[model samples]
Target chain A: MTVTPDQVLDCSGLACPMPILKTKKAIDSLQIGQILKMTATDPGSKSDIDAWTKKTGHELISYEQAGARYIFYIKKTK
Target chain B: MGETSKRLAIIAAHGSLDAAYPPFILATAAVAMEMECAIFFTFFGLEILKKGYADKLKIAPIGNPAMPVSIPNIVGVLPGMTSMATGMMNGWMRKAHVAKVSELLNIALESGVRFIGCQMTMDVMGYKKEDLIDGIEIGGAASFLEFAGENAITMAF
Candidate 1:
């Protein structure tokens, strides 16, 4: 499925905990059911974001890797 | 707001620059995971809460063999070794895009991660509430345990 995000956040060049922190802050501004497209350069973000999605009950529509950037399509739930 | 069921409780017992990152990083990450988080600063860890202390924290290389640059114990004990070690680590962190400890501390506070200063430690150290950054609640072990409660993942740094 092609998921279009309602908002985009760039966490490039930030290390662990920062991408997650910024992602949380950005997602907080979006409405429930809206999607956030987050791009991160940290390699650890793959597992971290998945774990965050699982713990927070947010939906991870899809994730892609473009060169050094890891892109995530996240949908806010509740 | 109805939050998640998980929680994180951190006991920060060290104040050295190398030892300071874990609690703040874990607490903030736990918050982003939608978990309740609190950090209790005791003993040396209380130094992290002092206003303007982050910039001055030092990493002693003598005891730390894993420092990016290995130094002989004798050499590491020389004057200014701690300063040099701290500077080198700071440079590495900057290159790695890691946020400063001060910045992480602010993120934790702004994100609602609870910070509890040990009241007895403050008393022993002659630290007044004004000596610490604002928004931290002063309390003792019992107070922190009360906040940690049950079912929270507990860790110490």
Candidate 2:
């Protein structure tokens, strides 16, 4: 099954906090129930984003590895 | 997976650039995790709150155990060695895309991390209110300890 995202954020070539920082900023613009697709090369972003989503009450619908990129789809729950 | 602690308090006691990053990074991460955070900068650490001081903060290689290479105490005393070491570390962080100290400070502030400057330290060190950055609350040990007392965790760095 394919889940389409309402928004996409590219965070390649960034490190640790940048990906999480950018994700936090990007998610604020999303409406409730809207899905944000984030792509990053930083391996740490996986757990960082996971932790962020859990804390913020966002839904982490998907975390997939496609080739060299790690992709995350988050839904704003609040 | 239960509700994480909603508050965190940190005491930053060192002034070196290398030492400074941990508190800011942790504060930022805490805020992102929806934790209310406060950072109290005391003594040398208060230098981070002074206007235009973050960029000037340097890691003195002399007697620093974490330096990549150890130099003799006499050689470490030479002029320009601190600057050279600072430059090397800055360049490495830049190449690795680590956020600069100033940038991290801005992020932490914007994320609503409470920035507090120790009043007793400032008075003893002869620092005035205008010497620090805006949005900093001048606080005494009791005030910061109050915040710490209410929080689940208080860490010192």
RMSD of each: 2.5, 1.6
Model 1 deviation from the true structure expressed as Cα RMSD, one decimal place: 2.5
Number of the predicted model whose lDDT against the real structure is largest? 1
RMSD of 2: 1.6
- Model 2: per-residue lDDT, tens digit, B26-110? 8988877778899999999999999999988998888877777776768879999999889888888888888888999999998
Candidates in order have lDDT scores of 0.91, 0.88
Per-candidate DockQ values are 0.89, 0.71
lDDT of 2: 0.88
lDDT of 2 at A78: 81
Q: What is the lDDT of residue B8 in candidate 1?
A: 91
Which CAPRI category fits model 1? high
User: What's model 1's lDDT at B82?
Assistant: 89
